[model samples]
Target: MTATATIDEVVCLRPATSTDFDLAGVINSLLKPVYELPGAELVHHLSGIGDVGRMIQDALDEAPDDLYATGVPSSGTDHAVWPVGGTTVEAGAGARLAVGITLPVDGSQDIFLWDQDASSDDLLGSVTISEAEQGQGSLSKLAHSDEEHSYYYVNYHVD
Candidate 1:
């Protein structure tokens, strides 16, 4: 019955429920890193950038390819950073945070949270959590943490 007034910053919710949405499977094994495909077939390799929410920070600190994520489009194996575009379901608040993202073609997801008040672009920290298949690492750290902000997801059919 109510909506945020401006696109200056917005949250967009995905389909609430999907016949295709397998919460159990996703929890078990849906979002797994993509390794089967040859690296050539890899559209891109996602890298989690830390504390890079500011556009000015991007200029001061070089991105992986030494290019800016805000400028230029994703091309070839550029390995550029892109914000994933979608809605993030926040716990407790029952309020969804609208998110924008550009990620790899596979299960590996680079997590980014935009902070409106702190930075101009409105982002805070960068944490990279790969497909759950990574087993244990930073991804596991966030997964196992008491709480987490957002995640990049993929949908696969078990049937």
Candidate 2:
């Protein structure tokens, strides 16, 4: 008998025997975007992304009224750029890279990844970091690409 399953509406694989089946192989082939929840609710900005990350946190630490007055904390709006954290790295082609990001609030946040080397700062894509994520953790493949050295700028905020 053969075992088969439908994965992500694409790719079908059959296993001749249960013992011979490789689950890891199937997971690796599925290149679908994953949306994950945060491990903990974050009330403060995560540290260690350099100065911009700190400055954004400073602006957000102010009172809501003050934030509104200064227009620095751009929370609760679409298309708003909130500084979460960022890093630049060099990796081999098709290598999986892990990035740790900390976000504020116990709500949904969008994580944006950009290629700084590009003229337009080309946006690759975004993944939603759910409330289940902790203030600090590692996300795989934020640096995943075919390029020998990838330059990434990551930013995100609660929405």
lDDT per residue (tens digit) for residues 24-68 in model 2: 234324421221212111111222224432342233231111000
Model 1 over residues 5-70: C-alpha lDDT tens digits? 110111111111112334423432422343223221121232122322222123323121111122
TM-score of 1: 0.22
Best candidate according to TM-score? 2
Residue 147, model 1: Cα distance from true site in angstroms: 16
TM-score of each: 0.22, 0.30
Q: What lDDT is obtained when candidate 1 is compared to the true structure?
A: 0.24
Pairs that collide in candidate 2 are: 37-133, 38-130, 38-132, 38-133, 39-132, 39-133, 39-134, 40-133
**What's model 2's TM-score?**
0.30
